[model samples]
Every structure is written in C-alpha cells, then in structure tokens.
Target: MFLSRCPLSHTRSGTAGSEAPATGETSLGDSLGTFRRQQDILTPAELAGMSVDIVGAGALGGAILLCLCKMGFGITNTLTVTDFDRCEAHNLPTQWFRPSDVLMDQAKVDALAEMVGWVCDRPITTACDRFRGDESRRLGPVVILAVDSLRERQLIWNNLRNREDVQLLVDARMGAEVLEIHCLDPRPSRRGTTRPAGPGTREFYEESLARPDEAFQEPCTHRGILYTTLGAAALVGSILRAHAREEDYPRHLVFDFRNFILLAHGEGHGETQF
Candidate 1:
C-alpha cells in the first residue's frame, strides 16, 4: 500500500509539509487566530450591531462583564456599563478587580470599563449612576440586571418594560452557592383568552429585594463565592450565545452549586443534577 500525502504539504512557504508562511503572505493559522483565540463558542458576529448594557458591577455583574469580554463581546459590540458603587478591599475576593484599583478615585464601572477596554482593545462606555424610575432610558437594547437588591431589579425592569427600544433582558441573582438566571424578551403573551389573563392588568415583573436582616445590602463577606460565580458566568455566556443564534433559551435557570443541582424552566419548571 502507498503512504498517503501529508496535509501540511498544502501549507505555503513554497515547501512541502511546512507550517511557516513566506514573507509578505499571511498563514491560514494567522488568519483564523482571532477566531480560534475566542473564549466563546459563539461566532465573532454574535452581538453584531447590538450593544450591551449591564446595570451592576458587583460579584454577579462583574463576573458577567468579564465573561462577555473574554467571549469577544467587547470587540464585536459596544458595551455600556452602569454602577453607583466603588471598589473596596472586600470586593477583590469575588469581583473581577485588581488590588491597585482599590483607591484610584474611580467608580467600579469606570475602573473596570477602562481595564476591559485596554485588555480587549475595545472601549466601553461607563455610567457612574444608578438606574431608576418608570419612563426611564436604557443605553442599549439588551440589559443585564445584576444589581444586588430585589427593589433595584424591580425598578430597572419596570422602567425598561415600557421602552420599545429595550428588547432583551438578562436577569442574574445569586444567593450563597446558588444563582438564578432569567432571560426575558418582554413580548406580550399571545395566548389571549386561552385562559383568564392572570393577575395584574398590566405587569412588568421584578424580584422582591427582601433580605433576612434589617439591612438590604449583602454583607461584605457574603457577596459571593469564587466557584459559584465562575459557573454562573459561564452559563450566562451560554445564554448570550443562544440569543445570538436565535435559539430558544431557558426562560429561567436556577443552579445550586452546593448540591450540584440544576433547575431549568421551560413552559414550566423541572429539576435535575449536573
């Protein structure tokens, strides 16, 4: 039997089985380097013309911002981030931040946005203010509600609900070792008269910002765990990719890292182990 020809034989450099490229010519690998170095499975055009707006820069929000950046979100899409918080020593444990950024007179969004721009070669806009009220505005069509409290989430959601400009919403909530991710399109339910339209003559849903203590904010130590956020950020990245592909994504996902359990909602809810 005759030996087969080597695949590398076709590579340029005017020599058989050579990987090097000739001067003035780019190699195939060089051409696809950008594509292959991507941290996401989604295509480069994945957010395309649409921009992203993230409302928080804490554990969950910070993780999501960095995750999307790694996935080439910064390169392909304009990213608008908003937060009224600052980076402190305690935040270094759970959020994507550096120690030197602690006292730079920079807001959380300003610091991270700068880092992301430098690292990703894409400049992202920053708003060092809180999002509030009905009839408010959004920086982009897609919004990520990564705020700390339920009341904050409700406020932003209710405000964004009426905006024809706001089309997609990704809500992320983390509790100890578990996190809930919900992707909402905010489309009016088409099944009218299918049953008596449930409560609220008109409804724009948001989570209850209720916490056990008299204090609403999470204790500094209880912000989040490193492990839980890694998994949650990866999952939310998947959600963004699914949106890019126009695939049917989970309306709600609750992942419990404590027991390795996963709860996903379809038309209804179901649970399973990862």
Candidate 2:
C-alpha cells in the first residue's frame, strides 16, 4: 500500500487543503486582519474623552491636577476645578501654591488651569464657586471629591447621584498617616440613581458643610507633602485608569505610607489591613 502520499504535498486537493487561508481567500483574510489591527490603534479622538472636575484645591486636589495636566492628556478633555477657599500660608509647602500665589485669590480652577496652560499647553476650565447649587450641575460624568470633610463629601454625592451623566465618583481622604480612596461606579440597571452607601455605612446623600469640631474649613491632620501628594496622585492615576476603561475596579486601595504597604479592600463588605 502506497499510503495515499503525504497530505501536505497536495495544496489543491481535499477541498483546497486545511493549510490554505479560510475560503481560499488569503486577500480577504489579510484585509480583515489588517482592519482589526488598525482598529486597535485608535487615536485620542476615538477614545472617550476625559472631563475631570475636581472640588477643593488643597494637597490632594492640587497634586492630582498637577500630575494629570503634566501627563498632557488633551485640551478637549477639560479639567474644571471648583474651590471657594484660597490657599493659606501653612499649605505652601505641601500644596502646590507658592509664596507669590499668597493672598492673590488662588481660585482652584484659575490657578490650576494657569499652571496646566503654562506647563502642559492644556487649558483647564474654571468654576470658582462651591461644587453645589445649580452651577455645579454643569460638571457631570466624572467628579473627584477631594474635600476635607465628611459633610462636603456627602453634599457632593447628593448633587452627583441625581444626575444621569456622572458615572465615576472618587472620594479620597488623607489623614496624617493613612489614606483612603473610595470609588463608586454606576450600575447598569440603576445607572442614574443616587449612589447608595457601601454595605454597612450610612448613606450620606445630604452632605452639608457643617460638622462641629470638624468643620468643613477645619484641617483634620497635618500630613507631610510626601504622603499627601503620593497618596492623592496614586488615587488619581487609578481613577484615570477606571475612566479610560469606563469600568469598576475589584477593590478599594488604601495606602498606609507609615507602614509602606498598600492594601486593597474587597467589595460587598470587608476590612483590609496593610
């Protein structure tokens, strides 16, 4: 028995052999592959633009704005910041403000945008008022609530939750030694509803600017420049990643700078130790 010769030897036999391109059309297959390859190389315009509105211009917000602007994302993806407070003398070192910026009405939006324009050639927009009332409703979809008080955080959610456009809500707080970053991604079914508090926590839908012994203007802790910016910048980078993907992360990242360890807390309900 000759054993039917080698199957690979006959290119045109047995229904055009399995080695040939599907349907005997290498050109079509090559074209389809090339199309997919080209699709993967999408431009900035093709990607969903990022419009980040940061509330507060203290250590966290200032650092986050500086880092994001320096990254040179784009002009169209505007950064609109809101802060009714000005930079204080003590915040000079850790915060991004300089001596010249003192008493000069360093509105968070204007000052940060000016810096972005000078350095990144990207101009950030401004809304010098507080991130509440009818004016704040203009800024939707992405909100970085970096305020100092729980009251302010609650107020931010009240405004953001009612809106349909806002998808990502990031709340980052840094004490003297610990830093916590909370992220709430919109749900598919109730994407427009107000954000419900995490499993055991109370719903802070009406965050006012009042909490005696811990006033909105009161500074909770004296964080060094290293940890403040380090933690806030990291959180901003994480939010940007989530924004770029338009998805939710698996856990909340808590950075304990004093211990030099990063802890990720699971969703649903759980505690994590660094």
Candidate 3:
C-alpha cells in the first residue's frame, strides 16, 4: 500500500507517525488530516505563507487565537503574539489560561504560546513586553490589536496608519456584554484606488478613539465576560475567513450579547440577531 504525504503536516513534528511504520503495518494519518472537513470553505492553500501578529493575549486575544488554531490556520501560517501581563486568578474567568498557569505566574504571551503548542504545531513568537510603535520596525501584514486601552489603540494606529507593509488591522474591544470590532486597512489613499479602506476609514476610526479617561469605566468585576470574548473571537474569525477568500467584509461591527443584536457598519450596514 502507498501512503500519501499530507502537505499540511509538514510543520507538525514528533506526532504519532514520525517513525516509519513496521513492515505490513498501516500508518496513522498525520495530525492535520482532520482539516479535510473544512476544505471547501478554506483550504491550506488559501492560508499559505500568511503571517499574523496579535498584540494582546488577554480575553479576546486568547479566545481568538484558540479559534484560529482549531481552524487549522497554523498549518502554513506564522503567528507572533505580544503581551506583558502575567496570568492571575481573575484572568481565569474570562481568559484562556488554566488555574495552574496562574499559580505558576506565567506571562500572558508565554502561557498563551504554550497553550497554542498543545492545540496545534504552530510556533508562536512571544514578546513578554509591551508593544511600542516607535520601537517596531514593521509588523506582520495582518495585525490584531487587542490591547485594552483607547490610548494604546491610538498609538498603535498612529504608527501603523502610514505603513505600506500592513494591509489589514482588526481591533477588538469588549466590555462585559458589549463587543466592538473594527477592521481597517492602514495604507494611504491613492487616486482611482478601489480599496475598501482609505482616508474615510481612518477618520471614522479616529472618531471612535475618545480620551481614555472620558470613556466609560466598567468596574473590574464587569469588565470581561467569557461568552462576550468568545463572540468577538467568532466575529474575528469571520473577518479573517472573508480576507482569506479575497472578499469584502464589514469595516466595523458591534454585538450586544445581552440583547442579541448585531450591527455591522461601513460597506455592509445592517442590524440583525447574532
């Protein structure tokens, strides 16, 4: 019998079949073979050579990373994650870390990377420090900005707005039951360009970034909810799926889990139940 080598299995090492099977024995298929189920929706070819940078490993960031891992995104894609905080007891309720992770006092990115290793073969480049726009030379073409503060978002956007290397940016914000996601293209506008994002997009994003002190402050207990974070992650996955297909997606969206309402803005403006 002839065994077919799976292309998506190349990155995964030391799985069940690294050794040659004994004579007359059948080999267990590679770990990524399960991806066959979603072949029609997203193939490994669509994600080949893709690189993504996730700038936070808090509630929404951790949830999104797990969702992507389960979707076989790491098969042929590079992922980099940055976060400076350490796991704590409070994080357990909303974030992805286990109780043991908090006991060990692991950094958020480090703990998240370890969890990703268990879920998939994707190697995550972790930075246990804050992301400073001035210090960064270039980020991945696709960036997920999941930082908590409005000021941090402003700083990141200022650094990325004029960058030619960055094409897509997804910003996720959540407060207990309400979630907001913004998708932007940071490239400068050119005449006759048909890109979905341009000067108008930048202006709209800037308007949403009010002073941090002025923004509504939810009590610590009401800041994050697991279901809301998961909902945000699912919406992010939808945006990425559309991007992988080279299709258009909403530029901004808001989902109120408590009310079961979803409002999409820019290009595809509508209200519906989520």
Candidate 4:
C-alpha cells in the first residue's frame, strides 16, 4: 500500500531570501513549483514523509539518486547513502562525480550529497563506510541496492529478505549496454499461500546470484557507459513512480540498449524492440 499525501511545509534550498521579488518577476515559490505537470503521476507532497536508503554511490546509484532528487523525493525525510569509495578521475564519465570532487578526494557519498544539494534543497545523509548487512541502525522502508558483485548482493539480500520493516527493495545490475532491475517486496508471504508477495520471489532472485568468478567481468574501459547508466536510472524512477501511484509495475526488468530491446515480467509483462 502507498502512503497518503498530507499537508506539508517545505523550504526549497537556495530559494530563501529576504529580498522581495522585482516587478514582473516570479516569486521563489513560483519558480520552485515545477512539479505541476507531473502532479497527476506524483506530487512533491506525497513524497514528503518517505524515507529511502541507497547503497553504493557508483554509476547506477549516483544516477538514481539524482533522478529522485529532481523528482522532489525525500524532501521532508533525508535520503541516506552509504559507500566507502572515494571519487576518482575514472568516475567522471559514467558516474556523477565532478573533477573538483575528485581533486578534493571526496568520498562518493559525500560528493553525491554535495552535488545533489546544489540542484535540490532536500537534505541527504551520507555514510562514508561500506554496508556489510550488519548495521546497528535500522534501514529505511525503501532500500535501493546498487553495489557491485554478486556476492555483495547475496549477502545483503540474506540480511533483508525476512525483515518486516523493509517493504521494498530495488536492486539494479548493469554491464556495459545491458541492465537488469529487480523490485522485490521483502515481506513474508501470507500463511499457506503458494504465491509470493512480489515478482522477485526469493527462489528467483537467489537463482540470479553466483560467485564473483562465475559472473562475466566487463573490461575496465567498457564497464560503464553514460547513456546506459542514465537509462537504468530512468527505469528505477519509473518503478518509484508506480509505487507512488499505487499502480502495478514490472517486478523484474532487463534492457539491452545495444539492440533496443526490453524484457519485463511481473505486474507488467512484455518483450519489445525498437
């Protein structure tokens, strides 16, 4: 079930000022009212109280976070991001780090928070440490797992699969022009029920996991492409939008950008090519 929208008061970052508006100029509130067109799909008010935790600050994670920010998500509740890696020169092409961030030797989560703050007023919480599935603190209801390696995915899933607090888990995997997304509901299935709550059944997701060595390793230079990363982020945004709208969405989706083909299953099922 989706959360209900309520009255909320939010201050847009960089919009606060004592100066009055010049003649014929738009007010700060008017300028920040950019979501009217999308109000039918989702309004900023609906996202006010939602909390989200995003693991990893690499290509997919960085892009996804930016997308959420632009959509006015996590405005009332801060978005939490955890990552141990620092921004490097190589992350410029596919990730969201700027050259200045690399020169400053900023941690990925910190850099992402700073960058996001510039465009969005929403607050972000950063953890400059790795997530090992054994944190003392509780995670938000929504978790987006974008860490590298199948082992990390397996470990994190094992920790969250049975947790009642975690309602939605979105996992994104990418390799060059190929991208896969899994939107799983971690709540346990009802008693004596044969079907799982979401499309990402434990059995199906577990089958996708394997040893690190068993997975194909993309060459360093071809590991991430800017367009592919953005595409994956867009898909992730669509899933969030569906949830906000209380509509059905694909539980699992795979996209091959090179061939312009998409394969999706669960609530929405289809195979199409352009």
Number of the predicted model whose lDDT against the real structure is largest:
4
- How does each model score on lDDT? 0.62, 0.55, 0.70, 0.73
Candidate 2, clashing residue pairs? Answer: 141-166, 155-207
Q: How would you encode candidate 4's per-residue C-alpha lDDT over 195-240 as one tens digit per residue?
A: 4533566656666775667765888877878899889989999898
Stretches of candidate 1 off by over 4 Å are 1-32, 37-40, 133-138, 187-220, 267-274
* Candidate 2 TM-score to native: 0.67
| Runs of candidate 4 exceeding 4 Å displacement | 1-31, 189-198, 270-274
Root-mean-square deviation of Cα positions for candidate 4 versus the true structure, in angstroms: 8.3
lDDT of 2 by residue, 149-224 (tens): 7766666665555665665666777767677676655324464343355421123222222352453232445545
Residue 162, candidate 2: C-alpha displacement in angstroms:
1.6
Better of 3 and 4 by TM-score: 4
Worst 10 residues of 2 by lDDT: 5-14
Better candidate number, 1 or 3, judged by TM-score: 3
By TM-score, the best candidate is 4
User: How many residue pairs in model 2 have overlapping backbones?
Assistant: 2
- Where in model 3 is the C-alpha error above 4 Å? 1-32, 135-137, 189-200, 268-274
Clashing pairs in 4: none
TM-score of 1: 0.74
List the lowest-lDDT window of 10 residues for candidate 1: 4-13
